[model samples]
Target chain A: MKIALDAMGGDFAPQAAVAGAVLAAQQLAGKAQVVLIGTEEAVRPLLQEYGPAAATLELVPSTQVIEMGEHPAKAFQQKPDSSIAVGYRLLHSGTVEAFCSAGNTGAMLVGAMFTVKAVPGVLRPAIANFVPKLDGGMGIMLDVGANADCKPEMLEQFGELGSLYAQYVLGIARPKVGLMSLGEEEGKGSAVTQAAHQLLKVNPHVHFIGNLEGRDLFNDKADVIVCDGFTGNVILKMAESMYDIMVTRQLDDEFFARVNYETIGGSPILGINDNAIIGHGVSTPRAICNMLMQGYQMAYAGIVDQIKDSFKS
Target chain B: MKIALDAMGGDFAPQAAVAGAVLAAQQLAGKAQVVLIGTEEAVRPLLQEYGPAAATLELVPSTQVIEMGEHPAKAFQQKPDSSIAVGYRLLHSGTVEAFCSAGNTGAMLVGAMFTVKAVPGVLRPAIANFVPKLDGGMGIMLDVGANADCKPEMLEQFGELGSLYAQYVLGIARPKVGLMSLGEEEGKGSAVTQAAHQLLKVNPHVHFIGNLEGRDLFNDKADVIVCDGFTGNVILKMAESMYDIMVTRQLDDEFFARVNYETIGGSPILGINDNAIIGHGVSTPRAICNMLMQGYQMAYAGIVDQIKDSFKS
Candidate 1:
């Protein structure tokens, strides 16, 4: 299997992306290869500095670079030769099984939707993040920032999408799906949540576990929690900030350490035809490695095909 | 000043309430008196155990109790003699300057709306929680769980309400108000947030600071962050769970230690006709004391009157 990495993405891009590609290549040797897409001149020196492990890397030079602050849709359309744009082109043309970026999230989302397109029967694609569970496990949460204002049907789809990702990608045998709400009761939450809960309850594809509250976020309550992007995004950032605070205050602990974005690397944009992972813009070498590893795992697991099959059934 | 305590509310109930009343009585002295409403038989003995500190306590026997699981509006109507209901009555009848409880949150909200009512010109009343900032100061966030689905106008009001609370109750001279969004940009939130941002930007009453992302929750970026109740509640509970995880992991530090709900005590139900503080259901005696102290501060500061004046203009 081959995964394309956007070398021009992220704050420490080119260098971090090169190092991550090198590390991922070493870790997934014989199993997968990485195609680093970026300006050859900028990436070659770093690849040489990283030494022997960089041997597995295949650089696909792309001249254009998408800055972090650029409009995603516009940049993806205008900068066809940008690393992110080139990476998407490779995935779309079946040159690479997956593409991952830590660059402009908007551009990544735009590229995924416009390039590979959304899965059939999918209302909208969702981006899912892993919640580091207290039980030394992880739970998948979807619509982390994709569709801010979601309808009941959209959220119901998210439950199925999250469940499939949990089972196929996260390897949870029977992913317990939950609707993230203010209260645990069925009647609680906004009109959207209440309507979504009703629809999710009868959805045979997902093992819906009713409603889960905020307290259950890091607990072993549910394997997949679905919420509107607005709510999910807030929870995701708040959780991220919590880890930041812990680090700033030097409250180093095993669980808190796992809360770092570097551990999970990036979130996958589910319901898309092809696999695409989005990393934090400030992703380090380790984060990049994990993100690439995640891409390799998703590609190897054939999650996209499985989701399509599930939707068909 | 007179403050009413729902003695029969919360998991620990009469014991914690009586203890808190005693503590508050001692702390307030000539400044204020506490009126504990509950079954005389259950509260009197606990108050007696605490001795001299209970001198400023005035017991108002309530015959009923609102269980945590009961319907808020229905319970308030059915159990008119319940501690929460009677406490509201005291505040409504001007028998007490303020009312507080750690009971069924919905019941308290129902009682506040039915009895004291929302201040004139207020779209909806909001509950504001204190976010302990990393800078050793605190910020206020509103609509924590009151109105799950809010209009742009309501969020605009929340900004004003949160700002006033910060200035008057929290003692911030010019509370900088921020609209909590997925991104920090002007047009980066849900439709409601976008519209609210436009309204907040020109609302001269508030020190509108554009948009604040979830990462700014514990930071010193804004003194008051406003969002819809649904998003606000999720963030609040998520933050609470973060603290719970820290405690469970024994990750003790100055900042993490300050994350304790006991430190801030309770959240005030803002935009109401009178001050009403709501504590966590499982609040300890210390939490209860802090809650009552918060109620005392709100009443003493004449926050409700100031809010009324602001709305009138």
Candidate 2:
């Protein structure tokens, strides 16, 4: 099996991406091979610095790089041989079991839509982010930024998608799914969330735990929290900010430490046809390596097939 | 100015309320008076516990109490003599400059609509919560839980309302108002937020700073953050939960400590004819005291009159 990384992606691209891919290659040696996609001129030098470790990494050449500020859709279309576009191509062709990138989040998401596409019965794909629980272990929340404005049905599907991620990738036996809302009561949310609640409750695929307030995010209440991208994005950013503040203050408590983006690595675009994860823009080598590990877990779990099976009806 | 409180409010009521009111009475001694409204049977005994310090407090008796679980509108209407209802009546009849309560949040909101009412030209009233800024001051966000759903116009008004609260009550000059959204760009939010973003930008009433992400809440980016009740409520609760986690871990960082609801005491119902604050359900004596002091500040600032003047056209 081959797991790919966009070597030209992220702030410290080529350097951090090449180094991290080398690390993942070392760890996934027996299980899967690591592939790097980038312009040969940029990646070869960084790969050379890794010496023999670089020998384990497969470098696939591309001529262009989709910049951080470029329009995702246009850039992906016009720069067909760009690292992101080429990475997606590899993903679509099943040449790589999973594709990971730390650059151009919008482009990565746009690439997902244009390439591997959504699962057959899935309404839309959602970006599922991990939540560090207070009691240890991890939970997942979906639609972090994939679809900012979602219908009730989309939110319902996010629940199914996130639950599948938790159960398959994260190894939660029967992930408890929950709808994020303003209040704990069934009726205490916007019209969309209220409607989504009923859909999730009756959905047989998940262990629906009902509506959860923002305070419930870090608790033991739910393992798979579902919300529209707008709400989930707000939460994801807010949590990141809190962790950043802790870092600034130099407070190193265990639970808050896990709140760091680097700890969780990246968010996976769920409900899609294949495994793809989008890392933070300022991802360090460690973050990049962890993202690759997560991608490996997702692909190894066969989570995309699981989603297709669950939503087939 | 007389600032009224519901003695029967909060989980530790009459006791905490009376103690908190007595504390406020001493603090507001020469400037304003503290008024407590509850059944004489419930409040008189608690006031007696404060000794002569309680003498400074003016006791306004009521016949009923609004339980936390009762319907807000029905309870406010049926229990006309309930503490919250009586407090609203005192506010509407000019007997008190402001009213504060820790009991039955729904009843307080219902009573506000029934009595003092939304200020003319204000689309809807919003509940405003204070964000403890990392820079040693306070910023405010509105529609925390007042209206679960809001229109573009309502969100625009929330910007105006929150800006006014920041300027007058918080003593910030030309408070920067930012619409909370998934992204900072003008085109970056849900349909309503995007529409609201344009409304806020063109409105001459506020110092519009464009859109803000959830991470901007505690930062100096926006002095007043405008968001729908659903988003604001989720952010507020999420902040509270983080504070609780810090406490559980015994991480006594000063900045995170301010995230505690008790530190801010209460959230005020803005865009109304009179100043009314809703306290935490688990209000401590200190929290209740801070809320009353805040009531005194709002009354002293004549915030309601300022809001009326701003919207008079």
Candidate 3:
């Protein structure tokens, strides 16, 4: 299997992307191949600088680079040869099993929707992030910013998607799926949440654990928490900011340290026909390496087929 | 001015509530009077244990108590003589300038809306909570859980209410109000937030600073942030949980120490006819004391009249 890395994306650009690819290639040597996607001139120098690990990495050059600030839909349409577009093209054409980027998140989403498309019977594809738990485990949360406005059905679908991710990738057997709500009671949320709660409660595919509040975010109460994108994004950003505040105050603690973006690396866009992972824009080389590893893991797990099968039944 | 406290509310009720009222009465002296509202049998013993400070307290006996688990609207309607309902009745009749409770939050909201009512010209009443900032300052966020769904106009009104609270109660001059959004860009949120950003940006009354993301919650960028109840509630609870996580881990950091609910006490129901503060249900004596002090400050600031005058213009 081959995992395509967007070399032109993120603040660190080709340097961090190339270094990450080399590291991923070395670590994932017989399991998967890492393909760096960017301009040949820019990526070649970084690959050379990475020394012997570069020998294991394969380079797939593209002509254009999408600016971080450009509109995703417009950029993807205008820059056909851009790294993100080219990477999507490779994934769509079966040249790579997965495509990963730390670029314009909108462009990645737009590309995934137009190129690989959503899995059959899926209402809307969702992106999920890892929530570090206090019990020395990790939980998964979905639609962090993928769909800012979601209907009740979308939220219900998120529960299924999140549950699958936890079970297959995180190895949580019978993952407890929960609706992110304002309170613990059954009818204690917005209209969307209340309706979604009913849907999730009856859904046979998920191990529904009722409702979980913000206080249960980092606890071991739920293995997979589902929410609309707006709420999930706020929770995600707030958690990130907590880590930032802890670092700025120089408070050295194990739990806060685990909150770093570098530790989780990237989130996978679930429900899509093919695997697509998105990393932080300010990703370090280590973060990039983890993202590549995550992309490899997602493809190896055959998540796309698993989701397709789940939705089919 | 007289402030009413619900002695039957909270986990350590009667004891914590009575002790808190005594503390407030002593600290406030001639500035304001504290009235304890509950059954005489439950509050008298606790007040007596408080000794001399208890002598200055006023007790308005009520027959019923609203349990924490009871439905808010139904309980407020069924138990008309409950401490929360009686407190509202006193506030409505001008017998008390402000009312506060560590009881059922829903009951308090129901009472505030049904009894005292929203200030004229206010689209919707909002509840606010204090957010401890990294710069050793405090910021106010509104609509923490008042209305699960809000219109663009309601969000615009929240900007005014939050700003007034910050300016008068919090003592920040010309408080910068920001629309809580997923991103800083104008078009970077759900449809409601985008519309709210436009409304808040053009409203001449507020010092609108455009859109603020979740990271800005603890920063000094905005003195007051306005969001719909759903988003605001999630952010508020997430912050509270952050404090909880820090405590459980025993981080012992100065910033984390400030995140204590005891320091902030309670949130006021803004845009209402009279001052109404809601404390944590598991509040301690220190938290109760702060809640009563906040009630005194809200009444002392004459926030209700100020909001009425501002909206009338």
Give the candidate number with the greatest DockQ.
2
lDDT string, candidate 1, B1-313, tens digits: 8998999888998788788778788888888888999998898888788777786788999899999999889988998899998998889888999898999999999988999999999999999898888888999999899988999999999999999989998899999999999999997999999999999999999999889888999888999999888888888888888888877777778876677888888989999999898999998888999999999999988999999999995
Give lDDT per model, in order. 0.90, 0.92, 0.91
Selected candidate, larger TM-score, 2 vs 3: 2
lDDT (0-100) at residue B52 of candidate 3? 83
Residue A276 error, candidate 3, Å: 0.4
* Candidate 1 clashes between residue pairs 3 or more apart in a chain or in different chains: none
Give the TM-score of each candidate.
0.99, 0.99, 0.98
- Tell me the lDDT of model 3 at A187: 82
Candidate 2: fraction of native contacts reproduced:
0.88
| Model 1: chain B TM-score relative to the native chain B | 0.98
Ranking by TM-score: 2, 1, 3
Candidate 3's TM-score = 0.98
Q: What's model 3's overall lDDT?
A: 0.91
> Candidate 3 DockQ score?
0.78
List candidate 1 segments past 4 Å from native: none
> If both were scored by TM-score, which would come out higher, candidate 1 or candidate 3?
1
RMSD of each candidate relative to the true structure: 1.1, 0.9, 1.2
For each candidate, how many residue pairs have backbone atoms clashing (under 3 Å)?
A: 0, 0, 0
Q: Please report how far candidate 3 places residue B148 from its true position, in Å.
A: 0.7
